[model samples]
Target: MNWTVISDNWLFFLVGAYPYGPLGGLLLTLLLAVGAGILATLLGIGWGLSLTLTSGHIHRLLQSVCEVLRAIPVLLLMFWCFFLLPIVFGIDVPGVLTVIAALALVSGAYLAYAMAAGIAAVPAGQWEAAQASGLSQRQTLRWVVLPQALRIVQPSFVNQWVTLVKDTSLAYIVGVAEFTFVANQVNSREQVYPLEVFGFIALVYLLLCSAVQALGQRLLVKPS
Candidate 1:
């Protein structure tokens, strides 16, 4: 309705006070999502390998850790990282970094399950063949199992990334000033264009999520 509010604050929505000061808004949101996604992916891969490759106590410990992490809410994780860690550790961690840390831990736990499912999807025959070919377990995993697992789980990984992008909105909880935070700020200041402000950001999120879906489809297609 009130297009003027959107017209005035679009830059703030896209990149709040970038050159002028700290980065915020959609750009910062993307940056945080990307950082967390990368870290989570690496953590997931390591955890997944441990889950699939190890046995007895190591496997049970990792499984319990994943379960515990998964059971905890992301909001609670962020609160602990931002508010509790400082008091406990007596170290000053930046809000943005704390948000990323929380996101990565939560995302990593979920993606670890995805990675485990991917590893399990690998054919038993493949493992038998790898073992018969004089390869050790680690060698077979590195050379045979992981490659197939990664390919099988590409779409799932992309879906997790999309989820991560949306999850970055929670960064607003810790005063991280992401896209949602900027939109809320605009609404609070203008008091007249809540629909316009929120609608615009919703469209942005739709486009970003759609782009990620398209990328997943493209990557899934086999080359001729």
Candidate 2:
């Protein structure tokens, strides 16, 4: 099925108009996923902690908001931010930035819930031991609790991250030339080789996801 088309345009598929146009393609996909995932990881820490640490209305409110974010689709959030922000706030949000924001906002909520669960999974004795050792509450969480909790949640975080990477294809709907977008563009012109082109697309996604999953499994291995 005309494999040369794939072989010929591999660079474009990987990098997209780079060195000549806007930055995009698989590189952009990874960038978006990494940027969004880091943002989510940091924010999730706060949101998640509020679940277990905070109380009263503040806790309920944070929980509600995170739940709402989790309920909404990423594409809807992207549309809201990309279109409404500029028109309502008089801000011109870049397309790539909007995708990152949307992905982070939604996925971060899940990460927050995962993080809270991870913290809960740590035995009560560990908390007591830290307290008996005279570590302050903040110090206990910062130095003792979070590291272990992070390790527990690492696999879940990696899963979310890989999903975010695949979701970057949505950027194409708004004109960002991400991996899927580039593939679609190429396919439209050389319509005869859909299988060869898209087959490569699937392979790229499989490799990226598999590598991430393997990394997570490696982290699960106990240290000697």
- Best of the candidates, lDDT: 1
CA RMSD of all predictions? 1.9, 1.8
Candidate 1 Cα errors over 4 Å, as ranges? 218-224
Model 1 clash tally?
0
Tell me which residue pairs clash in candidate 1: none
Backbone clashes under 3 angstroms, per model: 0, 0
Angstrom error at residue 9, model 1: 1.3
**Full-model lDDT for every candidate:** 0.87, 0.86
Consecutive 10-residue window with the lowest summed lDDT within model 2: 215-224
Residue-level lDDT of model 2, residues 14-123, one tens digit each, is 89999899887889888887898789877887888878899999889989999999999888899988889888999998999999989988988999999999899888
